[model samples]
Target: LDPASGRWIEDKLPIYDFETLDDFERLKIFEKPLLAALSRKSFIGDVLGKPANERLYGSLAAAAIAVYKGAHIIRTHDVPETSDVVKLSGALRSRTSVVKEGRYEVSVLEVKTPQDAGIAMRNIGATKTGSEVMQEKSIHLVLKIKNLTTTEALIIKQEMLARGGDAALARDAVSHETETTDVLVMGTLLQFGRLARKLDGQARSLPLIAEMIRECISNRTNLEYRYLR
Candidate 1:
């Protein structure tokens, strides 16, 4: 018995859909161990009542709703069917839209020389190139820096901060306690483009890092790339 709620307790076999389940018994039956069994029974009954091909429609519908609502890692026995449903749901959710008013375009610029990169940077503006227009939007990026010392990680963080972006190092990176860590970079597309330009020809690893960022920005579905004059 629960002292606070004044509910009676009982020890009995778990049952589903009782005409009158005392509060304690109802709670116990709804627990994972008993509920799982009840769900299996219900699923089997649903399958038996439906045609062979239509047996999984209800389950697939539920899976689709879950995917559309941003649920990840759905567990199911129907992998092929569930995979198709999830893929379709994700494709629908990732659809992009254009606004006729107060709209901005995101582009990636690749320059070989510092002079060219500087010229590209100068073209970025609010109305001209949409630079600094995405103050309300921030892009999160993660990069795995294998075998980099803490000093190098700090340098990356500082460089990112100097470019109007921020970066977070893995635990103990500043204390010189970690040999390697994943760096999380947060910024808009404009900031990332500037960072990439800054990284070019700076170091062997930095150029590679810049390329990785460029590739990711290029592949993003939400953004369209255009050449800068």
Candidate 2:
């Protein structure tokens, strides 16, 4: 043991093949130095691009390491969820992002149930009144629904036009047209939230929201949204 660095350095060990996690665990326990070589960096995660809540386990491990390493700052979306553990360990600290908020208009175009979506938008507004900003844009909605019959699809189209949302249909000549909705929409961010809130009730709708929003940004269209999935 060297007193300068306060550690023992092991020189030899076989790298484990990751055919099985159990073998990796055994190798770490029996062969690799478990605790002696550890520091704050021990808990660094390899979780690039994972959605926020999915990183909870890694976040917990990371917080533990933070406490171990005397960390003063951690930026994450699941703040309230992680704060409890950090508090119990006496590592809680206060911080908030300080930046000027930007303004944008959102158009809410196609939603399964528009009324319910409105409720969710209201709830979000109430929850983040001061720190967040939102604007609603008036617009048209066009949809190309796949599963609907001719008559039922027409009814939905009529409803959208009556409600000021433009609704389109799948092209008749194209082979792949029947599989997806062809919607033309224009709206602001708040309207998009209203539409999203309408669809937010179902578990599978989250990806729809993410995809639509992603398209909206990537395409840079006043067209607002295009929901394929």
Candidate 3:
């Protein structure tokens, strides 16, 4: 790594393939923090014909995307602004919370799947059966659903909220001013499963929605090979 820029300076310095970088799971293999650099002198600034001093917003936007793409540390000249961007971007990537009092501490864990929760539970010597049951409840997911009837969106929001989860619906859906609205559903695997099962018994297009939710969860958990078949 170059000390001046905190990035590798090699023969291919001019070309950075961010999409390729994002696709690779370096953290899973090396257990090392990935540091990403966002600079005013980057190609983005060049494309905008902006000087270093005038590229702050572009750099901040890059930094936020970097965080969402799994960069643990962001190397940027603008510390205060970048810090806010990082925090917000990270929150969007996953919901996290922390609490500390004296020597006791509790925090919401970030697990990508039930398998990840199972591994963590095993490490802590939790019972296999108990772990298997709790694992599905431990991981959270956020799914954005598009093109739903306003009534469907409103029902989804109410159902999710009643199930200890939540759904964000467009304001027009709540006000019944729009025919269709988009919704963002947030819940654990167990809650989602329950929601799908409940929706299966509901009238209208809800049975179809239930099927879609089941397919979504299955696809998410096995995306690497789901398309191969």
Best by TM-score: 3
Per-residue CA lDDT of candidate 1, range 206-229, in tens?
788788778876654322222111
Clashing residue pairs, candidate 1?
none
Off by over 4 Å in 2: 1-135, 138-163, 171-177, 203-207, 214-229
- Residues 1-229, candidate 3: write the lDDT tens digits: 2112212444423223332233323233233577766667444454467878899997887778777856788888899989999999888875347799999989865566677677778777898898899998987889889999988888888889989999998887788999998899999989999999889998889899989999888976453434232
- In lDDT terms, which candidate is top? 3
* Candidate 2 lDDT by residue in tens digits, 1-229: 1011111234311111111111212222122232211122212222234544356666565554443333334444466866675675444432323344467445332322233334445555544443234223322233233454444344444543444454456665133435434344434444444544544443443436435644554443322222111
Which scores better on lDDT, 1 or 3? 3
Which wins on TM-score, candidate 2 or candidate 3?
3
Each candidate's lDDT (Cα)?
0.51, 0.38, 0.73
What TM-score does candidate 2 get on C-alpha atoms? 0.23
